[model samples]
Target: MPTHYEGSKKERIALDSFIKFMRASESVTSKLAHGLADYNLTMSQFGTLEVLYHLGPMCQKAIGEKLLKSGGNITMVVNNLEDRGLVSRKRRESDRRFVSVALTEEGTALIEEVLPHHVELIVEMFGVLSDDEQQRMGEFCKRIGLAAASEEES
Candidate 1:
């Protein structure tokens, strides 16, 4: 059955494109989340680990910014990782009030084991797209993200 939308042609077209974009994002993320489940990690936890793995220690606030997560959400993720002995927070010598979170040896080892497989999964998921199509898609996403960020700042 064809779904009918009540809107001007341009508005309906824009809405249809937005819906497709969001559904594509959700579908990709759902697949990736299933892949991470074998390691008992949520997407947020994996994202945090990936950032700390590549970028070294960062404060909770910094991690939140990098993940585009709220402070409370990041705190919860960090606490869970800490409980699992995958991460540790150390107070700064110069500013004891500020604590930086870093991956533990266990965390480093875990990410090392999982990252390659994770990358392979991503590659497999995007294999339907030609290299040029993937590149163009990336460029479009970046442009959209930049515009959204600028709107947020205004």
Candidate 2:
């Protein structure tokens, strides 16, 4: 649903656009999260695993940056994965402050199993758009995201 506020034209247009964008984002996230439930993983946990699986071992700070998650949230997610024996963290002898996160054998096996389904779901969701349209949409999203980031920094 669009905004019902009786505001200026620019405000009305921006509000409606924001509403649609959020709804679509929520819809996609919800769909993806539903599948995570089957694996007994939260969205954050799955994201952590996926990033570790793809990006290899890295510090928690790097993982947080990649996931756009907070340090505390990343810590919790890593802790949960650790409890499940899906990942491990090791501190370098030289610099104990630098702990690297990596997928264990079980984690590797699980993500290998899950990634295909995840990709399929993503393809299905975006399949509504043609290749060109999807490309254009990605560009638009990135541009908007950059603009928003700059706005936030100002």
**Model 1 lDDT on a 0 to 1 scale:** 0.93
lDDT tens digits by residue: candidate 2, 1-154: 5568888989898898889899999999999999888989888999999999888999999999999989999999999999999999999778887899999999999999988988899999999999999999999899999999999988
Q: Write the per-residue lDDT of candidate 1 for residues 49-84, one digit (tens) a residue.
A: 999999999999999999999999999999999999
Q: Estimate each model's TM-score.
A: 0.92, 0.93
Candidate 1 clashing pairs?
Answer: none
Can you tell me which runs of candidate 1 are displaced by over 4 Å?
A: 1-3
lDDT of 1 at 92: 91
Give the Cα error of residue 53 in candidate 2, in Å. 0.9
Question: Stretches of candidate 2 above 4 Å error?
Answer: none
Q: Rate the local accuracy (lDDT) of all candidates.
A: 0.93, 0.92
User: Could you list the CA RMSD of all candidates, in the order they appear?
Assistant: 2.2, 1.5
